[model samples]
Target: MLLSAAARRRTPCPGGALLVVGDSPRVVVVGGGPGGYEAALVASQLGASVTVVERDGVGGSAVLTDVVPSKTLIATAEVMTLVDGSVELGVRFPGGAGAPTDPGLDRPGGAVTVDLGRVNERVRQLAAAQSGDVRERLRGEGVRVLSGTGRLAAPDRVVVDPADASADGPADGPADGSAGEELAADVVLVATGSYPRTLPDAEPDGERILTWKQLYRLQELPERLVVVGSGVTGAEFASAYDALGSDVVLVSSRDRVLPGEDVDAAEVIEDVFRRRGMTVLSRSRAQEVKRVGDGVVVALADGRTVEGSHCLLAVGSIPSTAGIGLEEAGVQLSESGHVEVDRVSRTSVRGVYAAGDCTGVLPLASVAAMQGRTAMRHALGDAVQPLKLRTVAANVFTAPEIATVGWSQAQIESGEAQGEVVKLPLVGNARAKMQGIHDGFVKLFCRTGSGTVIGGVVVAPRASELIFPVALAVEHRLTVDQVAQAYSVYPSLSGSLTEAARRLHKAPSVAG
Candidate 1:
């Protein structure tokens, strides 16, 4: 229900007279992910006393396990893949055995083994260090770091359960009990992020069968890895592990890999995966995963079983939005269990807001940060506008890294956007040839009549970074001729973007 001007005027701030008379209100944020931490900082800057309650470390799963660690591991994998290609580049080792083995690169079957023990240790260390930095920064900004889980006892009150071990006199346990501290606040920010989703039948054992979280725990690489799900997460791990020397089989329920991404970009990666000896299983649904002797068996819906030494399920993630008083607070949730919030992140319940993956907005850190900031602006009586999805840029971190921003060809063809698509292959680029990279393209979609760029796709090494200019063009309604005029380096891969735009300007028309 939308509030009327009279209702808004009568809504009382938690601080009562002090808040009404222009005193800063106390704002409590639960969860320390990007959304939570960013909101805490913003609220404190706006002169609100802020407290962040976190069960896990401050950076949440994004920094602690998912994005940072996975990207770092990908970096290592990239280096190894490049080194493996050295033989073709005339970089030879004596006796054809490659260079003298670095103990770090040595793994079973003469492949580069990621020392997961060292990797996990390093990942945790980095996450912890980053978390500490966030905590200190929040403290500097006058936001209290409350280390515990937070529960909303009332619409205007939150209760924090402190670490259990602190009161138990340090026995085998950390601490035992406390009544818990209650905090009264004007506005509550719920940014508790998500976790890896698992199935009851294919539950992870943290050993042979695992989720993305348990990947860093291993000391040795698997002999063979079978990845279930063909979405972004599944594709990323499959690509990374294949590069890391695991004989990988990626099972996809869709006709192609990365169903959510640009169809052409997904096809390119799928083709590359096939060429690299990673088995691609399309339209295969894994019904269950059971542990067999020394290996895991994946039962498909078709009565066929695929056995591998290890199985990693990457179906998707469920929002972390239960048992935190959302229902009691009357916050509306979607049918899929996502918190239903406006573009500015206000929940159905007054004085409550949500951001990040919980709201089921685009699951990007950038989106989370934007939603959090917008929520605070709306709640604090600042001039606010609802979010515009048109400007969002997203990237899939894969071997070639698929990045996209505005209009999509499929959408245009389906009459969603009456646009023309111009695709430019990387083989025509001088730089791609010089770099020994030949597989990728730059694709641009624009309103045929107006010549304004509406969407674009970049499929190349560092495509994530290169797609931004195109994204900006789409967001700002820049024309193909305008983009073509911009100075791209003489011999760079990014030149393909401008060239693609130039080509789109030359195109007469598209069916749409």
Candidate 2:
């Protein structure tokens, strides 16, 4: 689904030497993921003829198997959670509690059943449709789409293998008859994303033992699910499956779930998971995984074993920077195989840029998009700015999402940041009480000397939405007192934002 177009808006040339009418600089983008397509569009807009070559759909992993699909499934699971309390809310179940009146104490069939086949089908359909829409949008923008695998043969040379083109065909043959066909580009942007990392002893069978990417192939909910790794993806799947009625076991190598997240947020989720019957095995490392009869067994490094109907490995992701001509082009790779780049996404080799997961920045779609645009600007000698992690906002998509922007509580507590801290619990919120909600809080950190908002965390349903205010405050350099004075709804969950800010304003003066 990678597409590129001729320039809709052209850049003026200084001497007209490189701006010849028939020889405009041709740029080829490899990968249809966020980084590739985004840059393709921008490069086209900057007067370069652009072409995007991709092996899969336009939206890449974020759209196809990860973000869009997982979020859609989460939305469905949320509705099921809401509907399960119909009786408690005084609403009749599909079959009234005692409609027959025969056996007053009779056990009813399942209150609701999820058609996994239909649900998965819908997930795939929506994902594919969205990918197609992106392709169409690129086409409308005049970008050409090439369905193929692309590789760099040299700094200014590329080879594309059309998905259906024969290996022996002239178009499929590289200029030197190398493995890949050879094409030329004035500049190359490597945006190939990544795949879910699999353990050496535990391989994904797309069934019993699976990676996060392969879980989309499942048509039936697992009776018992065991998730390995307590990272962002692992925690998200564990929380989501628990809400969807799976007996889940989360294995963590650290002392707590989401060890890298804010401690308070991690504790809140850990407590909720235990309360909800999710077996969280902290300080446990999965040494190996194997199939035992109809179930799977995860052998822990501590000699403990967990058996479950399905096992999901979310240890991490490995960049797809291999098998390309990255090394051949003098582009440096990190020790972990990531493309080594500076803040501007430039590789060691000039005219070569890498972005997104390949660059080892936070693997968020938003960050990937930003990196891509910045790379295009820099590559084309336009305006360029380095990536700023200080204002980046990342959200872990658990039940009560944990969203953090700027500095973390641990940073302040460890004296890494000179900031005052304030926290407001949701238990006292009138709207939260009305909605029968609890177990959430708003926390803020402000610079002690200047009172300028520095960082914050929000733990709540729709925390992703609520974190925007904190992100804005940090970006605009708003002071805690100014934030406290901002108007918030009288009886809304968002009121906690103002409350936290007010507390920050009351903190005693401190020195950096």
Candidate 3:
């Protein structure tokens, strides 16, 4: 049973720039994750009375178990790697009185060791803080935040059942059985993100067998961590754990790790992993993962077995769209069970839109936020530009992180796009020499004759930050000359980006 709209208490939106003549348009946003909460903010600004129904906390999985927590853990690993490598640059500890220290670039054997317990604690604290901050922000904007399971009664009506909880994120919030609240909405936005995919034979026990989300629960680091899957998630965990002084075994079904990423970037990361003594089992598919005593054993499809203290499954993720009452509302879903949405984040049904991982567009968080914002702009009758995937910047948070923007090399090779390419190794950069860095490169693409910046890839320490300029150029169709004209700090890794662009610069034609 749903409560009447007249009986519901509407949130008093604090500051709305857009003034409404009559009754403010009611917007019911389903999911409190990045897409859902972000849309709520936008809808509120547009003078729409917004109500967000979320099963988990305000920040969603990105803040709870996924992006925020994982990245915080990786930051510790990164500091260890940097300090361990800094020994070569004449930095010595108390024991080394006068002589140059041996940089353990091959493997980490320094006195510095990470406490997984402390690291996990910090990760959890940070995530909780972020979630709380988001909740307060939504409250400040007067967007009603309901912590309960939400379902569609119709395209424009949503019912929040406090008795039912959702499987979104890694939340275990207990539901209360109360008469649910009914929302009368002129528009509805669904931003329910995806959950980590699991195999029936290798179900996560959260002990020896775990998912990426459960990694933070571990007090002591695994003696030997076995990461199954060679994709972004698998590679990242493998890299981080290895740098954290754990013997890691990476199981991959493909020939090389990061099969979906850029080829050159994949090669650099794989080399780094192998050189650091991490065992990579390529073309090995795990058939089953089960506990045998204290440790876990993984049986491969090729009749081989690998044992480890813990196993982290990173196969992929499935969109959390089931049992949400989307189809009943005439919203068409894809064969993969993802909500089918257009450029403006519209579903097949009118007045109902979908975004984020649930739409199966792209798995990046930045992409999700853009999709959510675009959806609201269209819904509120504001001038809106459709979502442009090409302008979105993506990062792989590995050691010597890989970042990409716009066109990929494969698109050029396959004749799908016409562009000029230039590859510059970071070894030549002054910053690389000073920092004792020897691997990674910067690759840039541009229009053939016009020299317009089309795309770029950066591989280095914190490449995520370095790729933004390239993203800016690609989005605005800036020329190679324009990119080169922008000043980059000398003796810095970013200089390589402009240098790559400068290589593609063409001088003005003079009368012969």
Give the Cα lDDT of each candidate. Answer: 0.79, 0.79, 0.85
- For candidate 2, which ten residues in a row score worst on lDDT? 167-176
Give residue 125's lDDT in candidate 2 (0 to 100).
Answer: 81
Cα deviation of 487, candidate 2, in Å = 1.4
The residue-by-residue lDDT of candidate 1 on 272-308, one tens digit each, is 8887789999999999999998899999999998999
Measured with C-alpha atoms, the lDDT of residue 372 in candidate 1 is 86
Cα deviation in Å at residue 365, candidate 3?
Answer: 1.1
Give the C-alpha miss distance for residue 148 in model 1, angstroms.
1.6
Q: Between the candidate structures 1 and 2, which one is better when assessed by TM-score?
A: 1
Go through the candidates in order and give the C-alpha RMSD of each one to the true structure. Answer: 5.9, 6.5, 4.3
lDDT of 2 by residue, 27-85 (tens): 77888788888998888887777777776667777778878888888877666555543
Please give the range of 10 consecutive residues that has the lowest summed lDDT in model 1.
167-176
Candidate 3 lDDT by residue in tens digits, 1-512: 43355554443222211223367878888888888888999999988889888877777788888999989999999997887676677676654333333344733335577889999889888887888888888889988888777899998688887634433234533223233788778789999898889878998988889888788888898999999998999999998998888999999999999999899999999998898789999999999999989999999999999999999999999998988899999999999999998898989887788989999999988888888988988887776788999989999999989999999998988888899999999989999999988889999999878898989999999999999999999999999999999999998999998899889988788999
Best-to-worst order by lDDT is 3, 2, 1
Winner on TM-score between 1 and 3 is: 3
